[model samples]
Target: MQAVLRAACRAAADLLFPRNCVHCAGPVETGSYQYLCPACTRALQFCEPPACKTCGYPYFGSVIAPRECPHCAELEPVFDKGKTLFLAKGPGRSLLHALKYHQGFYILKDLTRMLKETPHFKEFLSGAILVPVPLHPTKLRERGFNQSEHLAHTLLQNSDARAVEPLLLRSEFTHSQTHLDRKDRLQNVKNAFALSATANLMNDTYYILVDDVFTTGSTLNACARTLRTAGVTHLRAVAIGHG
Candidate 1:
Protein backbone atom coordinates (compact mmCIF):
# COMPACT_ATOMS: atom_id res chain seq x y z
CA MET A 1 0.00 0.00 0.00
CA GLN A 2 1.06 3.59 -0.48
CA ALA A 3 0.70 4.23 3.23
CA VAL A 4 2.91 1.28 4.09
CA LEU A 5 5.61 2.46 1.67
CA ARG A 6 5.43 5.98 3.12
CA ALA A 7 5.84 4.60 6.64
CA ALA A 8 8.76 2.45 5.55
CA CYS A 9 10.42 5.43 3.91
CA ARG A 10 9.98 7.45 7.10
CA ALA A 11 11.52 4.62 9.12
CA ALA A 12 14.47 4.43 6.75
CA ALA A 13 15.00 8.14 6.89
CA ASP A 14 14.87 8.09 10.66
CA LEU A 15 17.45 5.34 10.73
CA LEU A 16 19.75 7.29 8.41
CA PHE A 17 19.28 10.68 10.09
CA PRO A 18 18.17 10.47 13.69
CA ARG A 19 16.08 13.43 14.73
CA ASN A 20 16.70 15.52 17.82
CA CYS A 21 14.37 17.67 19.85
CA VAL A 22 14.63 21.35 18.89
CA HIS A 23 14.77 22.62 22.47
CA CYS A 24 16.84 20.01 24.30
CA ALA A 25 18.80 18.47 21.39
CA GLY A 26 17.90 15.04 22.80
CA PRO A 27 17.02 12.13 20.55
CA VAL A 28 13.41 12.50 19.52
CA GLU A 29 11.05 9.82 20.70
CA THR A 30 9.47 7.73 17.99
CA GLY A 31 6.13 9.01 16.67
CA SER A 32 6.42 12.26 18.61
CA TYR A 33 5.00 15.12 16.54
CA GLN A 34 6.34 17.98 18.63
CA TYR A 35 9.91 19.16 18.08
CA LEU A 36 10.35 19.75 21.79
CA CYS A 37 10.92 17.12 24.44
CA PRO A 38 8.25 16.73 27.13
CA ALA A 39 10.33 18.74 29.56
CA CYS A 40 10.91 21.57 27.09
CA THR A 41 7.26 21.58 26.09
CA ARG A 42 6.31 22.07 29.72
CA ALA A 43 8.92 24.82 30.03
CA LEU A 44 7.47 26.86 27.14
CA GLN A 45 5.71 30.05 28.26
CA PHE A 46 2.78 30.47 25.90
CA CYS A 47 1.55 34.02 25.57
CA GLU A 48 -1.80 34.41 27.32
CA PRO A 49 -4.53 36.99 27.73
CA PRO A 50 -4.19 40.52 29.11
CA ALA A 51 -1.63 41.16 26.40
CA CYS A 52 -1.19 44.37 24.54
CA LYS A 53 -3.93 44.52 21.93
CA THR A 54 -1.63 46.00 19.29
CA CYS A 55 1.58 44.01 19.89
CA GLY A 56 0.44 40.92 21.85
CA TYR A 57 3.05 41.39 24.55
CA PRO A 58 1.90 39.34 27.60
CA TYR A 59 1.21 41.15 30.83
CA PHE A 60 1.34 39.71 34.38
CA GLY A 61 -0.67 42.29 36.28
CA SER A 62 -3.73 41.69 38.41
CA VAL A 63 -5.73 43.98 36.14
CA ILE A 64 -8.26 42.07 34.08
CA ALA A 65 -8.64 44.34 31.06
CA PRO A 66 -6.31 44.19 28.06
CA ARG A 67 -4.74 47.42 26.91
CA GLU A 68 -1.92 48.78 24.79
CA CYS A 69 1.58 48.95 26.25
CA PRO A 70 3.53 52.21 26.63
CA HIS A 71 5.79 51.37 23.73
CA CYS A 72 2.86 50.93 21.38
CA ALA A 73 1.21 54.02 22.77
CA GLU A 74 4.22 56.32 22.74
CA LEU A 75 5.21 55.76 19.09
CA GLU A 76 2.47 54.12 17.12
CA PRO A 77 3.88 51.23 15.08
CA VAL A 78 3.33 51.17 11.32
CA PHE A 79 1.71 47.75 11.47
CA ASP A 80 -1.94 47.60 12.51
CA LYS A 81 -1.26 44.83 15.07
CA GLY A 82 1.11 41.99 15.88
CA LYS A 83 1.19 38.68 17.74
CA THR A 84 3.90 36.40 19.11
CA LEU A 85 3.36 32.74 20.02
CA PHE A 86 5.46 32.69 23.18
CA LEU A 87 7.50 34.90 25.48
CA ALA A 88 11.17 34.82 24.43
CA LYS A 89 12.39 32.99 27.53
CA GLY A 90 13.07 29.53 28.87
CA PRO A 91 12.68 26.82 26.22
CA GLY A 92 11.43 29.32 23.68
CA ARG A 93 14.64 31.32 23.94
CA SER A 94 16.82 28.26 23.55
CA LEU A 95 14.86 27.12 20.50
CA LEU A 96 15.08 30.57 18.92
CA HIS A 97 18.84 30.67 19.36
CA ALA A 98 19.20 27.24 17.77
CA LEU A 99 17.06 28.19 14.81
CA LYS A 100 18.90 31.47 14.26
CA TYR A 101 22.51 30.33 14.71
CA HIS A 102 22.40 26.61 14.01
CA GLN A 103 20.72 25.05 10.97
CA GLY A 104 17.50 24.23 12.84
CA PHE A 105 15.28 24.21 9.77
CA TYR A 106 13.33 21.23 11.11
CA ILE A 107 12.04 23.36 13.97
CA LEU A 108 9.86 25.37 11.56
CA LYS A 109 7.41 22.50 11.24
CA ASP A 110 6.63 22.37 14.97
CA LEU A 111 6.65 26.16 15.26
CA THR A 112 4.07 26.51 12.50
CA ARG A 113 1.98 23.84 14.23
CA MET A 114 2.13 25.82 17.46
CA LEU A 115 1.30 29.08 15.68
CA LYS A 116 -1.82 27.52 14.19
CA GLU A 117 -3.05 26.81 17.71
CA THR A 118 -2.60 30.39 18.88
CA PRO A 119 -5.76 32.33 19.65
CA HIS A 120 -6.90 34.57 16.75
CA PHE A 121 -4.34 33.11 14.33
CA LYS A 122 -7.03 32.50 11.75
CA GLU A 123 -8.48 35.94 12.14
CA PHE A 124 -5.05 37.50 12.23
CA LEU A 125 -4.04 36.03 8.89
CA SER A 126 -7.43 36.26 7.18
CA GLY A 127 -7.28 38.05 3.83
CA ALA A 128 -3.63 38.77 4.42
CA ILE A 129 -0.51 38.19 2.34
CA LEU A 130 2.40 36.73 4.28
CA VAL A 131 5.57 38.80 3.87
CA PRO A 132 8.84 37.68 5.33
CA VAL A 133 11.10 40.45 6.57
CA PRO A 134 13.92 40.09 4.08
CA LEU A 135 17.65 40.08 4.67
CA HIS A 136 20.25 41.95 2.65
CA PRO A 137 21.89 39.97 -0.14
CA THR A 138 25.17 39.79 1.79
CA LYS A 139 23.53 38.63 4.99
CA LEU A 140 21.42 36.12 3.13
CA ARG A 141 24.59 34.79 1.50
CA GLU A 142 26.36 34.48 4.84
CA ARG A 143 23.39 32.78 6.52
CA GLY A 144 22.60 30.48 3.57
CA PHE A 145 18.87 31.02 4.15
CA ASN A 146 16.62 33.55 5.80
CA GLN A 147 14.90 32.12 8.87
CA SER A 148 11.95 34.53 8.48
CA GLU A 149 11.36 33.39 4.92
CA HIS A 150 11.34 29.75 6.03
CA LEU A 151 8.87 30.57 8.82
CA ALA A 152 6.63 32.39 6.37
CA HIS A 153 6.64 29.42 4.01
CA THR A 154 5.73 27.05 6.84
CA LEU A 155 2.83 29.28 7.93
CA LEU A 156 1.54 29.46 4.36
CA GLN A 157 1.26 25.66 4.17
CA ASN A 158 -1.85 25.71 6.41
CA SER A 159 -3.24 29.21 5.96
CA ASP A 160 -5.40 30.53 3.15
CA ALA A 161 -3.25 33.61 2.82
CA ARG A 162 -2.58 34.62 -0.77
CA ALA A 163 1.11 33.59 -0.75
CA VAL A 164 4.52 34.08 0.83
CA GLU A 165 5.55 37.17 -1.12
CA PRO A 166 9.05 38.58 -0.93
CA LEU A 167 7.69 42.05 -1.70
CA LEU A 168 9.95 43.91 0.69
CA LEU A 169 13.65 44.04 -0.16
CA ARG A 170 16.37 45.02 2.26
CA SER A 171 18.29 47.89 0.71
CA GLU A 172 21.10 48.39 3.18
CA PHE A 173 23.15 46.01 5.25
CA THR A 174 22.97 47.35 8.76
CA HIS A 175 24.48 46.04 11.95
CA SER A 176 22.56 43.40 13.86
CA GLN A 177 19.90 44.90 16.10
CA THR A 178 20.66 42.25 18.73
CA HIS A 179 22.33 44.42 21.40
CA LEU A 180 21.12 47.83 20.25
CA ASP A 181 18.90 49.89 22.54
CA ARG A 182 15.44 50.89 21.34
CA LYS A 183 16.58 54.18 19.84
CA ASP A 184 19.61 52.62 18.18
CA ARG A 185 17.56 49.71 16.92
CA LEU A 186 15.18 52.09 15.24
CA GLN A 187 18.02 54.01 13.67
CA ASN A 188 19.82 50.89 12.53
CA VAL A 189 16.83 49.75 10.51
CA LYS A 190 15.78 53.16 9.29
CA ASN A 191 15.51 53.26 5.51
CA ALA A 192 16.89 49.76 5.45
CA PHE A 193 13.93 48.30 3.53
CA ALA A 194 12.02 49.14 0.39
CA LEU A 195 9.18 47.68 -1.63
CA SER A 196 10.23 45.54 -4.54
CA ALA A 197 10.00 47.42 -7.84
CA THR A 198 7.81 44.74 -9.39
CA ALA A 199 5.61 44.15 -6.36
CA ASN A 200 1.91 44.47 -7.16
CA LEU A 201 0.27 45.41 -3.88
CA MET A 202 -3.48 45.39 -4.12
CA ASN A 203 -5.52 48.22 -2.72
CA ASP A 204 -6.78 47.56 0.83
CA THR A 205 -4.96 44.23 0.88
CA TYR A 206 -3.78 43.02 4.28
CA TYR A 207 -0.13 42.07 4.85
CA ILE A 208 1.27 40.14 7.79
CA LEU A 209 5.01 40.57 8.15
CA VAL A 210 6.64 37.40 9.42
CA ASP A 211 9.76 37.32 11.56
CA ASP A 212 11.48 35.05 14.08
CA VAL A 213 11.42 37.39 17.08
CA PHE A 214 9.81 40.67 18.17
CA THR A 215 12.39 42.38 20.30
CA THR A 216 11.70 46.12 20.34
CA GLY A 217 9.93 45.55 16.97
CA SER A 218 12.16 47.95 15.07
CA THR A 219 12.78 45.59 12.15
CA LEU A 220 9.12 44.80 11.64
CA ASN A 221 8.25 48.45 11.99
CA ALA A 222 10.74 49.33 9.29
CA CYS A 223 9.32 46.72 6.95
CA ALA A 224 5.80 47.89 7.71
CA ARG A 225 6.73 51.47 7.02
CA THR A 226 8.12 50.52 3.63
CA LEU A 227 4.98 48.59 2.78
CA ARG A 228 2.78 51.42 3.97
CA THR A 229 4.65 53.82 1.79
CA ALA A 230 3.97 51.50 -1.11
CA GLY A 231 0.21 51.95 -0.43
CA VAL A 232 -0.39 48.92 1.80
CA THR A 233 -3.04 49.97 4.31
CA HIS A 234 -3.73 46.85 6.35
CA LEU A 235 -0.46 45.72 7.94
CA ARG A 236 0.29 43.39 10.85
CA ALA A 237 2.94 40.94 11.97
CA VAL A 238 3.42 37.50 13.57
CA ALA A 239 6.51 36.01 15.13
CA ILE A 240 7.67 32.91 17.01
CA GLY A 241 8.69 34.71 20.18
CA HIS A 242 8.36 38.06 21.94
CA GLY A 243 11.84 39.02 23.08
Candidate 2:
Protein backbone atom coordinates (compact mmCIF):
# COMPACT_ATOMS: atom_id res chain seq x y z
CA MET A 1 0.00 0.00 0.00
CA GLN A 2 2.82 2.41 0.89
CA ALA A 3 4.62 1.59 -2.33
CA VAL A 4 1.49 2.24 -4.35
CA LEU A 5 0.97 5.58 -2.64
CA ARG A 6 4.57 6.56 -3.31
CA ALA A 7 4.25 5.58 -6.98
CA ALA A 8 1.01 7.51 -7.26
CA CYS A 9 2.64 10.53 -5.67
CA ARG A 10 5.53 10.34 -8.11
CA ALA A 11 3.16 10.00 -11.04
CA ALA A 12 1.08 12.88 -9.79
CA ALA A 13 4.24 14.94 -9.45
CA ASP A 14 5.10 14.17 -13.02
CA LEU A 15 1.63 15.01 -14.24
CA LEU A 16 1.07 18.08 -12.05
CA PHE A 17 4.05 19.88 -13.58
CA PRO A 18 7.41 18.41 -12.81
CA ARG A 19 9.47 19.13 -9.67
CA ASN A 20 9.47 22.85 -8.91
CA CYS A 21 9.82 24.52 -5.53
CA VAL A 22 6.57 26.17 -4.42
CA HIS A 23 8.36 28.90 -2.41
CA CYS A 24 11.17 30.18 -4.60
CA ALA A 25 9.61 28.92 -7.83
CA GLY A 26 12.95 27.36 -8.68
CA PRO A 27 13.58 23.92 -10.16
CA VAL A 28 14.55 21.18 -7.73
CA GLU A 29 17.42 19.04 -8.97
CA THR A 30 17.59 16.27 -6.38
CA GLY A 31 15.29 15.43 -3.50
CA SER A 32 12.94 12.65 -2.54
CA TYR A 33 9.69 14.57 -3.09
CA GLN A 34 8.90 18.19 -2.12
CA TYR A 35 7.63 21.55 -3.34
CA LEU A 36 10.38 23.63 -1.69
CA CYS A 37 13.84 24.05 -3.10
CA PRO A 38 17.00 24.08 -0.94
CA ALA A 39 17.19 27.89 -0.94
CA CYS A 40 13.52 28.25 -0.11
CA THR A 41 13.82 25.55 2.49
CA ARG A 42 16.70 27.50 4.04
CA ALA A 43 14.60 30.65 3.91
CA LEU A 44 11.59 29.19 5.77
CA GLN A 45 11.66 30.51 9.36
CA PHE A 46 10.68 28.64 12.51
CA CYS A 47 9.72 30.44 15.74
CA GLU A 48 12.60 30.22 18.16
CA PRO A 49 14.18 31.70 21.30
CA PRO A 50 12.14 33.39 24.06
CA ALA A 51 8.59 32.31 23.22
CA CYS A 52 5.66 32.26 25.57
CA LYS A 53 5.86 29.11 27.72
CA THR A 54 2.08 28.93 27.69
CA CYS A 55 1.35 30.04 24.11
CA GLY A 56 4.24 29.71 21.65
CA TYR A 57 4.22 33.35 20.57
CA PRO A 58 7.76 34.59 19.95
CA TYR A 59 9.36 37.23 22.15
CA PHE A 60 12.39 39.07 20.87
CA GLY A 61 15.53 40.16 22.85
CA SER A 62 14.53 38.97 26.33
CA VAL A 63 13.55 35.50 27.58
CA ILE A 64 10.65 36.48 29.75
CA ALA A 65 6.93 35.97 29.37
CA PRO A 66 5.96 38.75 27.04
CA ARG A 67 3.46 41.13 28.61
CA GLU A 68 0.83 38.64 27.39
CA CYS A 69 -0.10 40.45 24.22
CA PRO A 70 -3.63 41.81 24.62
CA HIS A 71 -5.01 38.63 23.07
CA CYS A 72 -3.69 36.30 25.76
CA ALA A 73 -4.11 38.31 28.99
CA GLU A 74 -7.71 39.34 28.23
CA LEU A 75 -9.39 35.96 27.58
CA GLU A 76 -6.69 33.44 28.56
CA PRO A 77 -6.33 30.63 26.00
CA VAL A 78 -7.77 27.33 27.15
CA PHE A 79 -4.96 25.33 25.62
CA ASP A 80 -2.05 24.92 28.07
CA LYS A 81 0.56 25.52 25.36
CA GLY A 82 0.58 26.63 21.72
CA LYS A 83 3.22 26.90 18.98
CA THR A 84 3.44 27.98 15.35
CA LEU A 85 6.02 27.35 12.64
CA PHE A 86 5.88 30.76 10.97
CA LEU A 87 5.29 34.34 12.16
CA ALA A 88 2.37 34.87 9.70
CA LYS A 89 4.37 37.64 8.03
CA GLY A 90 6.31 38.03 4.79
CA PRO A 91 6.49 34.93 2.57
CA GLY A 92 4.95 32.87 5.33
CA ARG A 93 1.67 34.72 4.98
CA SER A 94 1.73 34.45 1.19
CA LEU A 95 2.43 30.72 1.35
CA LEU A 96 -0.40 30.15 3.81
CA HIS A 97 -2.81 32.08 1.59
CA ALA A 98 -1.86 29.88 -1.34
CA LEU A 99 -2.25 26.66 0.64
CA LYS A 100 -5.56 27.62 2.20
CA TYR A 101 -7.22 29.59 -0.58
CA HIS A 102 -5.69 28.10 -3.72
CA GLN A 103 -5.43 24.53 -2.40
CA GLY A 104 -1.75 24.22 -3.19
CA PHE A 105 -1.74 20.73 -1.73
CA TYR A 106 1.80 19.97 -2.83
CA ILE A 107 3.20 22.23 -0.10
CA LEU A 108 2.03 19.71 2.50
CA LYS A 109 5.35 17.87 2.25
CA ASP A 110 7.39 21.01 2.75
CA LEU A 111 5.26 22.11 5.69
CA THR A 112 5.77 18.68 7.18
CA ARG A 113 9.52 19.03 6.79
CA MET A 114 9.45 22.45 8.41
CA LEU A 115 7.51 21.12 11.41
CA LYS A 116 9.90 18.19 11.78
CA GLU A 117 12.92 20.50 11.79
CA THR A 118 11.39 23.05 14.16
CA PRO A 119 13.59 23.21 17.29
CA HIS A 120 11.13 22.67 20.14
CA PHE A 121 8.28 20.92 18.31
CA LYS A 122 8.85 17.45 19.75
CA GLU A 123 9.53 18.76 23.24
CA PHE A 124 6.31 20.78 23.22
CA LEU A 125 4.37 17.96 21.52
CA SER A 126 5.64 15.24 23.84
CA GLY A 127 3.00 12.65 24.81
CA ALA A 128 0.24 14.59 23.10
CA ILE A 129 -2.32 13.43 20.54
CA LEU A 130 -2.88 15.62 17.49
CA VAL A 131 -6.37 16.84 16.62
CA PRO A 132 -6.85 19.14 13.68
CA VAL A 133 -9.38 21.92 14.38
CA PRO A 134 -12.28 20.95 12.15
CA LEU A 135 -14.10 23.00 9.59
CA HIS A 136 -17.87 23.39 9.62
CA PRO A 137 -19.73 21.00 7.33
CA THR A 138 -20.78 23.89 5.09
CA LYS A 139 -17.26 25.26 4.84
CA LEU A 140 -15.76 21.79 4.32
CA ARG A 141 -18.14 21.14 1.46
CA GLU A 142 -17.34 24.49 -0.12
CA ARG A 143 -13.56 24.13 0.20
CA GLY A 144 -13.64 20.42 -0.77
CA PHE A 145 -10.75 19.83 1.69
CA ASN A 146 -9.68 20.81 5.17
CA GLN A 147 -6.20 22.34 5.09
CA SER A 148 -5.70 21.58 8.79
CA GLU A 149 -6.36 17.89 8.26
CA HIS A 150 -4.04 17.88 5.27
CA LEU A 151 -1.29 19.45 7.42
CA ALA A 152 -1.99 16.99 10.21
CA HIS A 153 -1.54 14.06 7.84
CA THR A 154 1.76 15.51 6.72
CA LEU A 155 2.87 15.97 10.32
CA LEU A 156 1.97 12.39 11.24
CA GLN A 157 3.66 10.98 8.18
CA ASN A 158 6.89 12.85 8.88
CA SER A 159 6.90 12.49 12.65
CA ASP A 160 6.38 9.62 15.08
CA ALA A 161 3.26 11.29 16.44
CA ARG A 162 -0.31 10.31 15.48
CA ALA A 163 -3.29 12.53 14.74
CA VAL A 164 -7.09 12.27 14.67
CA GLU A 165 -8.93 14.30 12.06
CA PRO A 166 -12.20 15.00 13.92
CA LEU A 167 -11.71 14.46 17.62
CA LEU A 168 -12.91 18.06 17.92
CA LEU A 169 -15.83 19.30 15.84
CA ARG A 170 -17.50 22.58 15.12
CA SER A 171 -20.82 22.80 16.96
CA GLU A 172 -22.08 25.97 15.29
CA PHE A 173 -21.49 27.95 12.13
CA THR A 174 -19.86 31.37 12.49
CA HIS A 175 -18.70 34.26 10.33
CA SER A 176 -15.08 34.34 9.14
CA GLN A 177 -12.65 35.84 11.67
CA THR A 178 -11.18 38.32 9.22
CA HIS A 179 -11.46 41.97 10.32
CA LEU A 180 -13.69 41.04 13.26
CA ASP A 181 -13.07 42.77 16.59
CA ARG A 182 -11.60 40.66 19.40
CA LYS A 183 -14.85 40.61 21.38
CA ASP A 184 -16.86 39.82 18.27
CA ARG A 185 -14.38 37.08 17.34
CA LEU A 186 -14.77 35.40 20.74
CA GLN A 187 -18.55 35.76 20.69
CA ASN A 188 -18.82 34.53 17.12
CA VAL A 189 -17.02 31.27 17.93
CA LYS A 190 -18.45 30.75 21.40
CA ASN A 191 -19.83 27.24 21.94
CA ALA A 192 -18.67 26.45 18.43
CA PHE A 193 -17.01 23.09 19.17
CA ALA A 194 -17.63 19.83 21.00
CA LEU A 195 -15.91 16.47 21.45
CA SER A 196 -17.30 13.36 19.82
CA ALA A 197 -19.17 11.14 22.27
CA THR A 198 -17.41 8.15 20.73
CA ALA A 199 -13.96 9.54 21.46
CA ASN A 200 -12.26 7.37 24.08
CA LEU A 201 -9.62 9.90 25.03
CA MET A 202 -8.96 9.87 28.75
CA ASN A 203 -8.50 12.85 31.03
CA ASP A 204 -4.79 12.01 31.21
CA THR A 205 -4.14 12.23 27.47
CA TYR A 206 -2.40 15.45 26.44
CA TYR A 207 -4.13 16.74 23.31
CA ILE A 208 -2.74 19.19 20.77
CA LEU A 209 -5.35 21.00 18.72
CA VAL A 210 -4.12 21.63 15.22
CA ASP A 211 -5.00 24.47 12.87
CA ASP A 212 -3.51 26.40 9.94
CA VAL A 213 -3.32 29.86 11.47
CA PHE A 214 -3.32 31.37 14.96
CA THR A 215 -4.58 34.94 14.89
CA THR A 216 -6.45 35.94 18.01
CA GLY A 217 -6.66 32.18 18.86
CA SER A 218 -10.36 32.50 19.65
CA THR A 219 -11.25 29.39 17.61
CA LEU A 220 -8.61 27.15 19.24
CA ASN A 221 -9.61 28.45 22.66
CA ALA A 222 -13.24 27.53 22.06
CA CYS A 223 -12.23 24.05 20.92
CA ALA A 224 -10.00 23.54 23.96
CA ARG A 225 -12.77 24.67 26.30
CA THR A 226 -15.07 22.03 24.81
CA LEU A 227 -12.41 19.34 25.28
CA ARG A 228 -11.89 20.50 28.86
CA THR A 229 -15.57 19.86 29.50
CA ALA A 230 -15.01 16.43 27.98
CA GLY A 231 -12.17 15.79 30.54
CA VAL A 232 -9.01 16.57 28.57
CA THR A 233 -6.24 17.30 31.06
CA HIS A 234 -3.15 18.90 29.46
CA LEU A 235 -3.97 20.63 26.19
CA ARG A 236 -1.76 22.34 23.61
CA ALA A 237 -2.26 23.86 20.16
CA VAL A 238 -0.20 23.97 16.95
CA ALA A 239 -0.55 26.06 13.83
CA ILE A 240 1.38 26.88 10.67
CA GLY A 241 1.10 30.65 11.00
CA HIS A 242 0.92 33.03 13.96
CA GLY A 243 0.10 36.74 14.12
Once all C-alphas are superposed, what RMSD does model 1 give against the true structure?
2.4
Worst 10 contiguous positions by lDDT, candidate 2? 62-71
| Candidate 1 ranges with C-alpha deviation above 4 Å | 8-18, 30-32, 67-75
TM-score of each: 0.88, 0.82
The total number of steric clashes, by the backbone 3 Å criterion, in model 1 comes to: 0
TM-score, cand. 1: 0.88
- Cα error, candidate 1, residue 119 (Å): 4.9
Local distance difference test scores for all models: 0.81, 0.76
lDDT of 2 by residue, 99-140 (tens): 899998867756766766674775666556789888999999
